[model samples]
Target: MRSRPKEPRVPPDRRETVRHEIVSLLTGESMTAREISGQVGIGEKEVLEHLGHIRTALRSRLVVTPPACLECGFSFRKRERLGKPGRCPVCRSERIVDPSYTID
Candidate 1:
């Protein structure tokens, strides 16, 4: 039987590298957690955690655009924190837009 090839090991400093990359990407453009995950080669959950930790370290502000409800066009702009909303307060629609982040 042939053995499967092992995946390359991640560096010990991978978390720091990912955090740096996240800031760089956000500096260029605003993106959702999903988008950051794809570009940074990390899970969305990891991206969220990193964002939480790096909030005060960045030179520019970390802006989070709150998730919006698509059904009623309700903008969740007043939300004071990061993370997706459970449902639309106005329409109760689960079809909500994921919040995005940008450093500016």
Candidate 2:
């Protein structure tokens, strides 16, 4: 029988540190949720949840650079708080870059 590898344990403080780093990365440039998830080694859905808490901690000073439509110049403001939109409402473009939110 083969043994499975043990999962790495991350402390709460370390997790918070990682979260803070994520916010810092978003301060200037926008990053996709998938990218963030990959960097943080967590699920994309979890990144959204973490963002909610991070926003509240930052007192709504979170700068969100949501994905914009290239054809119609439509921004995903309505669906800005969470993950990236599947398609653009105005142009129906499926190409969406992940939004980045930072706490200032």
Candidate 3:
């Protein structure tokens, strides 16, 4: 198994701009948090936070499809949080699909 070196974190002052940039990027296609983090050079957790802000900033333009349990097809539409759930409540399955976001 191999590990990659870490990338430098985006400065606090620039986070706002990055968040806006993220929204602009999403206008073209839906993307998961991991993909956003990799492309934006930030951590996954940071990407999640930015997503929340994006939701607030672009209420009419943003569209988020909540994650679902692949095994039992349980939808997380009721969950208010921004990240993926750990397990499925109906079937207790760990095979959950990640939520995706896009800007309309």
Q: lDDT by residue for model 2 over 23-65, one digit each (tens)?
A: 8767766677788888777788988898888887888777677
Cα lDDT tens digits, model 3, 1-104, are: 99899998876556457887798779879999888888887898999998888788777577778999999888999887879889999999999999988987
When summed lDDT is taken over every stretch of 10 residues in candidate 3, the lowest stretch is 9-18
**RMSD per model, one decimal:** 3.3, 3.6, 5.8
Clashing pairs in 2: none
Scored by lDDT, model 3 comes in at 0.86
Residue 72 in model 2: shift from native, Å? 2.7
Candidate 3 ranges with C-alpha deviation above 4 Å = 1-16
For TM-score, the strongest prediction is 3
lDDT of 2 at 74: 83
Greater-TM-score candidate between 1 and 2: 1
**Candidate 1 residue lDDT tens string, 1-104:** 99999999975456558788898899859999999999988888888899987786764389888788889999998886677888988989999999999998
TM-score of 3: 0.80
TM-scores for the candidates: 0.79, 0.66, 0.80
